[model samples]
Target: MARLYHAPLSPFCRKVRLALAEKRIEVQLIEERYWEASPDFLRRNPAAKVPVLQLDGRTMAESSAICEYLDETRADPPLMPKDPTQRLEVRRLVGWFDDKFHSEVTSKLLYERVNKKVTGQGYPDSGNVKAGSKAIKYHLDYMHWLLDHRRWLAGDVMTLADFAAAAHLSSLDYTSDVDWNRSAVVKDWYAKIKSRPAFRSILADQVPGFRPPPHYTDLDF
Candidate 1:
């Protein structure tokens, strides 16, 4: 069995988890406080990242790379599209959520409201939280636009792009930060994805000192 060192709410780790679960890979989930940077953890990942995966007698760092490696190693139930153009589109949306959305929304909101408390950094920065709250509306609108045209974020099939987007959105959803009523299309897309068996662990996540909203695990919500 593989082993994963992860932080339950970290979007990157969550992305990898979703991909692994989608591939039906069984892994031992070990919660790690990457901020503390234990010697063993640092040895596993010099970067001190939460998602250090031990699999196939090798250690892997970075969520995107790990997901790709898994996708390559486990070809069945593919997470990436076969066509080059389609694959690029999937990668684009994955980067969009992991990099752009992460910087503009997740860093501001999750970092302020949750990470700070977890890391003992300080209280939530109201300005950053406000900015994140405002920025999410634009992202939600963008998602609505995408869903209006395609069955999924990147194309007609569910791909890694959806998991990447869901990883971030689910983290925010845990905090009740997402406005599900903002766009019915986006909400419907999320409801569909969230209903997947791969999302079970994500939905069951319990961050210390933080309680999820009742609707967090509600499939109908």
Candidate 2:
């Protein structure tokens, strides 16, 4: 069995987890305090990041790279498109969520609200919090725009792009930072993804100091 060192709320880790679960690949989940940077952990990945995956006698780093490896190795329920143009769109949206959305929203909201406390980084910055709050609305609206024209974020079929967006949104949802009412289409899209079996573990996540909203695990919500 593969083993994954990950932070529960990390979108990157969650993206890999989703890809693994969607492929029916069982992996051991080990939570790591990467911020503390244990010598043994550092030896595993010099970059010192969560989602250091141990598979097939190899240790892998970087969430995107790991996910792509899993998708290519396990073809069932593919997370990427076969067509080159569609593949480009999938990668683009994946990058949008993993990089742009992460910098603009996840880092500001979930990182400030939850990661700070978990990593002992002092209190959340009110300015950053406000900015994150505002930024999320626009992001949600953008998602609504995309969903209005397509069945999924990248195309008609679900792909890694959907997982990438869901990963970030799920992390924000954990901290009650996402405003689900802002976009009905986006909310509907989330509802579809949230109802998947792969999302169960995520919805059940419980941080020692933080509690999820009551509806976090409710399928109907």
Candidate 3:
């Protein structure tokens, strides 16, 4: 069995967990306080990041790399497309969410509201929270635009791109930061993805000192 060191609400960790669960790979989920950077944890990931995955006799650090490695090795219920063009698009969208969306929205909102408190980093920054709240509207509009044309974020099929976006959105949704009513198409798309069995574990996650909204576990919501 594989083992994962993760923070319960970290989107990157959540993304990797989704991929593993989608592939039906049983894993041990060990919550790690990466901020503390203990010697054992640092040895697992020199970068001191959550989601250090121990699989196939190797320790993996980066979430994207770990997920891709799993997809390549498992090959069942693939998370990436066969076509190079489609794969490129998937990678693009993954980068969009993990990089752009993360910087603009997640780091501001989730990090402020939940992570800071959990890590003993003091109170949430109201300015960052406000900016994150405002920025999510634009991101939701972008998702709406994508879903309106493509069946999924990258193309006609669900790919790692969808997981990447969902990872961020789900984290935000946990904090009730997402306005589901902002776009019918986006909400519907999320509903479809949220209903997947892979999302079950994610929805079941409970963090101390932070409670999810009622709709967080509601698949129909």
Q: What order do you get sorting by lDDT, best first?
A: 1, 3, 2
1 against 2, candidate with superior TM-score:
1
Note each model's CA RMSD in angstroms: 0.6, 0.7, 0.7
lDDT of 1 by residue, 1-221 (tens): 99999999999999999999999999999999999999999999999997999999999999999999999999989999999999999999999999999999999999999999999999998999999999999999999999999999998999999999999999999999999999999999999999999999999999989999999999999
Candidate 3 residue pairs in clash (backbone atoms < 3 Å): none
Model 2 local distance difference test score = 0.92
Could you tell me how far off, in angstroms, the CA of residue 197 lies in candidate 3 after the best superposition?
A: 0.7
- What TM-score does prediction 2 earn? 0.98
- Model 3 spans > 4 angstroms off: none
Clashing pairs in 2: none
* Candidate 1, residue 91: how far the Cα is off, in Å: 0.5
Clashing pairs in 1: none
Rank list by TM-score = 1, 3, 2
Model 1, runs deviating above 4 Å? none
**Please, what are the lDDT tens digits per residue for candidate 3 over residues 43-87?**
888999989999899999999999899999999999999999999
Best by lDDT: 1
